[model samples]
Target: MQDILGHLQRLGMSGYEAKAYVALVAAGRPVNGYEVAKRSGVPRSTVYETLGKLVARGAAFEVRGAADATDYRPLPPEALLDRMRREFDGSVDALRDALPAVAGAPEGHLIHNLKDGGALLDRAEDVVAGARRGLVLSVWPQEMARLDGPVRAAAGRGAEVSVMAFGDLGDLGGPRGGERIYEHRYSAPEAVLADLGYRLLVVVGDRREAVVGGFGGDGSAWGIYTADPAVALMAAEYVRQDIALQILAERVGGDELNRLFATDPGLLRLLGRR
Candidate 1:
């Protein structure tokens, strides 16, 4: 009963309305205001008023009988939920059509924090979907699975899509035609997994916006999303440098590349391993 009330409340019902509706539905037959007050523990003084509001909201119907008697019946739960879904969808569509015309003001630079893995993934997908010219990303296999559709969709729409993947992407599947995929070779996937306890993901869209984050195996994740040009450019450059390093590594071979980094004092100091 409490669960039902909670759900009803979420659906925009007030406490008295939810309680009164629950009582009516439990009765499964026509119930007068007095019976609803007694069964739902709603105060007798306000039970009629609550039922009237429920009727106005289409959550209940009032049955008319002889002698001015009115008994109320709740709308079936399944029917009520279906109607709510339809109404919500209609409202969303209406707002989608109406909002853009009213919202003509330019948006300033903004940063948002996404504190869950699902939200991070959602923002990444949105960035990919909105890419007009190019998309660059750094991702691991696990998240790549979730983002494959939007990435492919962006590429299909003529955006240049480039990926710098952290782990083995042998079966990583989505890229086609002009898309570029580079594997990062600085550390083994196992070493990264052990060291970070999480996988880092970054996406930059059309050089305009970016999302950067880490998803942990322990079910905690966090990300920052921003449309600030400087931040977005920094993220884009970070991925660009990773791609450049991969190309250099291919030319010099991984062993020779590591040998140079180890030998060069400046490089060693930059890497903080001196």
Candidate 2:
């Protein structure tokens, strides 16, 4: 019983409130401050104060009797939990509504030159960390390793993640449970190699908005952060195109295509096989 009081306190209940409520529930009757204090091991002088606090917090109710005595009764455990949940949900909604006017902010854009070394990696992380909805990306080993944390963070936040990589991008392993991964040999006839030359892109989009970035080896990167319907539609189209291409290539001849790709020494080396 004492441990139960401590458990309630650990769960964010005030010590006196926890004690008073536990006493009331155990007595299974409307209990006066003196009886509550004696049973709960609370100091007699502070028992009424504790009961008052419990009443204020909705953990217990005060009932008036004909003889000028007031009795306290604890709410049921499930009732208390339900009320707490409702209060928490209401608080969250209110906070969200108030935050926009107080610390509200807008979308951000950043650019980096690849020659900047580790800074390029940091910039990629920043982009992925801020993403919502989904991420569609094509990247190389170095860049992929750098952005791994941020990518997982996005996925943990409920963003859909699909990654296409050339060479090793760390085994498609991540903490977000799972990720949709596409691996290809960069030396293939396709101009859009998973790595080298072209650029690294991370696009996050929802039904109404999107954020897109173009990053490349030259240390040059560009971003368009927008919620405009037209921009989102155009960006979504490209995402659809990429998904389609991945499906097409995989379906056309996954094993045969990979075999042909392996023949290229440069690609095999990039893929860390040679």
Candidate 3:
């Protein structure tokens, strides 16, 4: 019962209105305000107003009763659901048509934070889907699983897609023609994440948009999606640099570079050392 009320609230009903409508639905016949209050646990003082709101919203119909009293009958559940679906779809359709016309050039502060892991994933998906020409992505294995479908679809449509993946991919699949995947030198994602203090995510699309984020072990995540061209280019370059480093390390050898970094004063300072 509570779950049903929650659904109604999400669809734009106040708690009183949801309760009143549910009461009318369960009543089987038209129910007066007094009976609605009793059944729904709403106070009698506000029950009539709540019922009136339901009637106004077409969720309930007012029925004339004996001795100048009025009763309410709920719209059938099937009809209510149909109405809600139509309204929701229509609003979405209208927004799709209207928004792009009004959305002109990039405005101030084009960067926006995605507040959590779910939002982070959503923005990443949006960036991938919006890529027309080409995209460069560097991501960890766990998130790559969730994003591979869209990535493959984008590549299948002939958009150039390059992926620099951290950790074991284990036969990562994509459209055969335009997609390429590079494995990071650090085979385990945890090694890279531990060195960086958090898991890093970077997605740059068509050299125009970018998303950068960090994920933590406690299910907390933070990210930003940016439309600034300079920022986007910088992000793309970051991943490209990583790819370059990976290639160099693979071919040129890691041991000598490790020795250089450990012994060279300039390189040590560059690594944030004393």
lDDT agreement of model 1 with the native:
0.90
Cα-based TM-score, every candidate: 0.63, 0.46, 0.63
Query: C-alpha displacement of 111 in model 3, angstroms?
Result: 1.2
- Residues 1-274 of candidate 2 have per-residue lDDT tens digits of 7798777886678887887788899898887888998988889999998888888888899898559889888889889988878987898799988888796464642222344445445544655665687666656665676677777777788888777665556554544444676665424514553444545454444534455555555666655555565766676676555666667666776666577567988868876987
Which lDDT tens digits does candidate 1 get at residues 200-250? 899999999999999888889999999997999999999999899889998
Model 1 — TM-score against the truth?
A: 0.63
Best by lDDT: 1
lDDT of each: 0.90, 0.68, 0.87
Candidate 2 yields a Cα-based lDDT of 0.68
Using lDDT as the yardstick, the better of models 1 and 3 is 1
Per-residue error (Å), model 3, residue 35: 2.7
